[model samples]
Target: MKDSFDDPPPVPPSERASLPDGLRFAFGTLTVLPARITRWDRPAARTGMACAPVAGLAVGLLAAVPGVLLLLLGGGPLLAAAVTVAVPAALTRGLHLDGLADTADGLGSAKPADAALRIMKQSDIGPFGVIALLIVLLVQTAALADVYADSWVRGALATVAAAVAGRLAMTLASREGVPAARPEGLGAAVAGVVPSRAAVAVTALVTAAAALAALPLGLPTALQYAASVLAALAAAEMLLRRCVRRFGGVTGDVFGALCEVAGTTALVLLALG
Candidate 1:
């Protein structure tokens, strides 16, 4: 709620020689916008995954601004909520949503893990994917609208919480115990990249910050929302386990689904928590 939204200046060529590599990679890869990337390396990948939440914070702040302005302009909460949902989708090129759809298609195939992975890999959307995306988007939109109608402050907080929740889900999806479902692609690149201790630290910090930001909802309610964030995190973790069991391990698509699932789950809870 009280942090800089400013993007850091590009690293000078001189500084690039000494600066850490993965920081820029996170922004460049996670968000649609351009960020200077140095050579790709395992350390860079690890750093990128570890600092994933910073990307969440940046985009989350951006996503909330339009909604906050709409509220102040008396444009009504529904419009603001719709904009809030649309902003991230636009910024990320809807990759997370695509992932959610693909994951759903794979799981809904009701085939074995190998067969399901094949379904997920196909470019075309399946009925399961379509339905899953619709439900997730509808629920997120409705919940965000309700919060915006109640309090713009809480609505803004919800936006930020959702962003961080997604990134936090990334950590869960790429945790130590998880393995890449394939030998190539994003899942292979980032799986197990984030350190265990760092994941816990980031998750705890984000959940606490979410709690503090929701304080306007009253102390008891704030605590409930905080607990809900944890529940969302737990849910995301369990989802990753299910993916592992169902698909043989985590995949790039799985990471995207985790982000959407975790973010939506947290936002929905914040609506009523």
Candidate 2:
């Protein structure tokens, strides 16, 4: 039998280059992308949600690769858009999509909070979830297609902005006042974890980065990027409010819904831009 003496020695954090724990948790929880975090430190996990935008930026960049490749190959815009939409889902194992569907089901049930939450917890998809997922995906794809049709440059920027917006929505939804609907799980771990000041700072940085990215396109386009981000944040606010009112607090599914809605809204707005 294995003995306690056989256990490996613990590696000190000093041996590492001050690896960002918040970033680790962000990547671990937000995407299936490769990020090494040797230890599952609880304190780090608590702050990780704040770094979700960084993960989202990675997701956006990777997701854009498919469309960018297709464009470089002279493929149809619709196909490129479809590929872009599929890449993030593929990378993340569709967890966010599943969450979006579940949250929709819960909210659409129109039942009391307990019954609604129970519906959300079920492994099966309800009619509302199915319809919501389908509609959101369709809208996002169509928007992306339109953007790609315009130019790959515009499309890429929009995709990145949308991706960042989605994570930013997750951050906003998890702010200090947002309560967890349940006593355990993701909601318990992340909801209300972000300080309001931190949220504002992170959001401002994201917005500034997005603006800088849009500068190459034009000042008007940069304004559009800002608008797109705002639209996403607004959608997230609505989703968060609904979750709070209906479920009495935030849930993991609610966070998922915020990401989807935020991403879709950002894409649509950017397409218009």
Candidate 3:
């Protein structure tokens, strides 16, 4: 065996400027960018899911800028919503949509837990996935129409908040000390490095920020928005816990499911507001 001193000293944070292309590729593909930095440091449970909220925040900001600009420029509500939705889709390369589809397929399946997992691993989409995606798009579009028509600034804030919070919930779901059904996958890798405390801290911080920003919508509206996001997060955590119990852990498809469910739940809550 080589001596311990033979290895080079650990890389300092200041010198960690350019990451390996594979690191960026892994992170970009997952759409969990913040977790990318964490992956480099301790590459286990926290990496995959953690980066998601950070990426979602960045993507949300990118989408919000255009929506705000279009609204300021006198563009119609539909145009603004279109821009908001399109930009996020482009950023994550429609990965969430695939998750939405897979989740639908799995949930709609009457098969056993293992069978549902098997179906999720398939690359092809089923009728359930198709129907679910269409309905999700319809509901989100309608909600955006209402939100934008009411107040463009509020609409932008809510959109950004939902994106960030949804991913935050997914990260939280990953911390239950369970292994995914599969032997090797990004989801399993992420679950390994994620510290339970970090998940709580991040979720709390984002929740506080989102509630504060929703104030412009009015105290009642802000409370409603906060309640809605929390409800979604709670539901997701319950579902993830159940899935872990049933299947023994969360997979890439499960992570996707969590994100889609969380996002949809948040949007529906905004609509309720």
Candidate 4:
């Protein structure tokens, strides 16, 4: 099977994008945000993946608002946590969750790569997909509820950190050397577009920022937040490796699975902390 997408025609240096263009691409592709993407070439994908955390941050903040308001209005922590979890799904139109379900079905099929990929592309969810979605959503909601019970501020910070961590996984997944499982669609467009060094730099920046965001809580909390980010990435990495071995590389479904895995791991760690 082919391991990568067929390259598009080379873009001229003069036609390359700036940072803003990349931001547009990130927001445009990653969320329901109104940002218009002006480019779709590899350079744009590189910038977009590098800026993915920024898009995640925006999504997190927006999602956090309602939960915070509900808490301020005396809503219970579980209710608040549910809303926080629901908002991101609404914003992304459940794209990631659907991806998670599809990926689960694919992996669970246990057939060869091509057969597994076909299973993933099917529209209907299978038993594995349903079970995976149920478990992940339950874990995310339960963990977040516990965090919210501790304090709303801590809960909000965890939500944001998880969101950022999820996108950070995408950045890492896009790093050069990762292959696309297919030769078309989102996986091909983004896979291997980001330089490894750039992905590392983005990861460091995001980890530092997450720790700094929790500093107001205390040094221990800050360190815990940093650890959560690392743990989240590690979880995502394990899944990515498995998908690569099982399916030959990544697809849109794999990316979605990575995001959810990372986000859930971050939330679980934050609750434990």
Candidate 5:
């Protein structure tokens, strides 16, 4: 599918400077919020991708509110988990889930890059896409359920960590040297826009923050949180490399897929801990 900002008209300098360009780009494109995107160039994308995790943090907090509320009000862990999982999907308008499905279809097709890309662009969901979505949602819900059963605080922390880790994957994916799969669309605009050093710095900061957030739970929990974030990023890197090799580079769909992969990985790791 074409990105909403694929060919956005230029915004006047005054309008562009009215809001922080990076944040506007981040929330505008990444969520169903009302943040207006004032710029669509590489500069905005660089800042947007760097701020992606901030957006994720917001989304995670929003999602956790209802689930935590439900658990506090006598709701079962399973139902609360389902709501927590559903909120993020609704907030993003299921863009990442759609991307995950499309990516699955493309990878499962086993066709040439061109043909697979064509398959991914189609509006219909193939068997691979259906199966991928089903499994991912199930795993995410189940992991959250287990965590929520332990305690609402841990569950909320897990949800936020997963959300942030997902966007952190996007930041790393956009680091210098990563290529876009096509010359047009979201991937082209943001791919390789962030410097490698900056991406690393963001990763470290996020990992530290995750550990610190869980510190009140215990030292072991704090270490587990940090490890989960790292593991999530590692999983995303593996998938990013595979997608680059298979499709030649990243796409909006690949970005979505990466978010889902990283989020799911983080939740699973947290549940295990």
Candidate 6:
């Protein structure tokens, strides 16, 4: 599928020019590969918002590719889980993870939003960030370790679904009143146009399908997985609303945090089941 995250080859000049002005601008970021798809322009913002669900779907599929490859390699469950982590690292070049680390350092310091956001922008990671990253990674590693050991394919699917659903939460956060931390930052553009209800429905539907799909293949309890996704979404919504009230809206850092939180929630629920 020609999804947004595939990073397709550049469109021909004639085709690019022929697109409606809105689409040209909406997809302009594709030409730049990993560049921010959203800009301050209204057309781009709305279009970018509309495209986020597709982005989630594409990214999820891409992340799953590695896990399947590992399974084919006869790798054990732990190795298969590791491949799941590696896939996102390669696809995003660790950008979201960096956001996770930075946000941890900044938020853990208990500073005001402006000051904390400034800290996050610093090149160096602080002790808090490092510790937080370690804990989050450890949780993921452990959860996948168990899942893969039991059912490699189920573990792989869970990982992919979590990645997709988590980002949807982050994207939904951007739909509210939050302004980007930086005037020209990537998060600013995309965050502003987030479609809250649409994001919720899309994520829920995808996650539900993932849960059901896994059932025929010995995945975790379907009810538990469904509940986990719902809980994660609820938690993210509450957190995003708080952030909006406190700091004005979701930033890239918050988005990263949302991903981590949602992913962890899914894993925890799966474990309990």
lDDT of each: 0.81, 0.85, 0.69, 0.92, 0.93, 0.63
Q: Which digits, one per residue and each the tens of the lDDT, describe model 2 over residues 1-273? A: 122224323445653223387787889888988776644543565467778899999999998988988998989889999999998888789888999999999988989999998999999999999999899999999999999999998888788888889999998887767788999888777877666766778898888888889988899988888878887898899889988989999888888889999999999988885
**What lDDT tens digits, residue by residue, belong to model 5 across residues 1-273?**
233224434445653322388999989888897898988887788778989999999999999999999999999999999999999999999999999999999999999999999899899999999999999999999999999999999999999999999999999999877889989888898898876767878999999999999999999999999999999999999999999999999999999999999999999999997
| Better TM-score candidate (2, 5) | 5
Candidate 5 overall lDDT versus native: 0.93
lDDT of 2 at 165: 96
Q: Better model by TM-score, 3 or 6? A: 3
Model 6 TM-score, all chains together? 0.76
Stretches off by above 4 angstroms in model 5 are 1-19
TM-score: the better of candidates 1 and 2: 2
- Tens digits of per-residue lDDT for model 4 on 1-273? 323344334557876678999999999888998999999988899889889999999989988999989999999999999999999998888889999999999999989999999999999999999999999999999999999999999989999999999999999999877899999989999998877767888999999999999999999999999999999999999999999999998999999899999999999999997
Candidate 3 structure quality by residue, lDDT tens digits, 1-273:
222224334445653323343245335655644433333333423444555576667777887888888989999888888778777767766777787687678767877878987887789999999998888777766777678877887778778877776677767866645566677675666554445665666677777777887887688877876786787798678767766766667777777767767776787788676
Model 2: pairs clashing at backbone N, Cα or C within 3 Å: none
**Model 4 clashing residue pairs (backbone):** none
Candidates, ranked, lDDT: 5, 4, 2, 1, 3, 6
Q: Among all windows of ten consecutive residues in candidate 1, which has the lowest summed lDDT?
A: 1-10
Candidate 6 residue lDDT tens string, 179-226 = 666665666766655344545555667667766866775544776667
| TM of each candidate vs. truth | 0.89, 0.91, 0.80, 0.95, 0.93, 0.76
**Leading candidate by TM-score:** 4
Query: Compared to the true structure, candidate 3 yields what TM-score?
Result: 0.80
Instruction: Please tell me which model should have the higher lDDT, number 3 or number 5.
Output: 5
Clashing pairs in 5: none
Cα deviation at 123, candidate 5, in Å, is 0.7
| Per-candidate clash tally | 0, 0, 11, 0, 0, 2
What order do candidates take by TM-score, descending?
4, 5, 2, 1, 3, 6
Error of 1 at 28 (Å): 1.5
